[model samples]
Target: MVLFAAGALLLGAGTTSRIFALTPENREAQATGPLTAYLEGQGENGAIWLKLRNGEVLKGRFEVKVGGSFGAYGKSRGIDRPGAAYEGSGRAIQGGSPAFVDMKGPSGATVHCEVVNDDANAHGSGVCLFSNGAEYWVLY
Candidate 1:
């Protein structure tokens, strides 16, 4: 079996598929359909694939741009200090970046996800908004 950091897919030459568990955000969608979503790193963009419990599948692609994170702001933090990082008041607010996802699901419906990650590791909790006016809590 292949493994990554904290279940995160280390974006290598392109051999990792990050998966996310989706929870319905609205009351009407709480009862049925659209369960999980996943992403596969492929260079600058990745393929976002989602499959519902009812057997319906949706195919889409997402592009990741590293922002407000470690590597992206190394020079700004401190070039002298090798491991210098930006710290906040509470643990809930750390100096990490968020990975955004845009998946076009079934019937022209779009899914937008914002996960806490460094582009390489697609891990964290976020939300996906379906174009059909449905929202879901996404955790990867």
Candidate 2:
């Protein structure tokens, strides 16, 4: 089973992944550069907390749709079914679905992410773009 419910992904799930800067300047300095940010999720949906070098923490949510079906997680992604499997949050997401994440930072900043998910194991990899002309590689 998969979980894509929405409310608060930063509530604490102890699951976190490191995101590296994909920028040219940051790329050359990545080995000794800043941590860039962090990415995490529960099921097909989760939140991104961007911890940039400027000591900024931007928060955002991620949603996924399988075969272009279903809607946002917070709206109608959590389809309640009886005798279903259990994984992550309490939502079921079809495997091989495309994921899109939208998160807003302070001062009109935003972070957008695109990920390819393997719902069976609740793990995925993708890329995230920050409004400040920064890009990051995401995995969790």
lDDT of each: 0.49, 0.46
TM-scores for all candidates? 0.62, 0.52
Q: Which 10 consecutive positions of candidate 1 have the poorest summed lDDT?
A: 1-10
Per-residue C-alpha lDDT of model 2 across residues 72-140, encoded as one tens digit per residue: 431122322221223234343345445566767577777665554444554444455556655454444
Clashing pairs in 1: none
TM-score of 2: 0.52
On residues 32-123, what C-alpha lDDT tens digit does candidate 1 reach at each position?
A: 54476666665546667776555556676555445533232222323113222111221232333544566654566565555444343344
| TM-score of candidate 1 against the unseen true structure | 0.62
lDDT of 2 at 119: 46
- Once fitted onto the true fold, the runs of candidate 2 whose alpha carbons sit more than 4 angstroms away are 1-43, 69-95
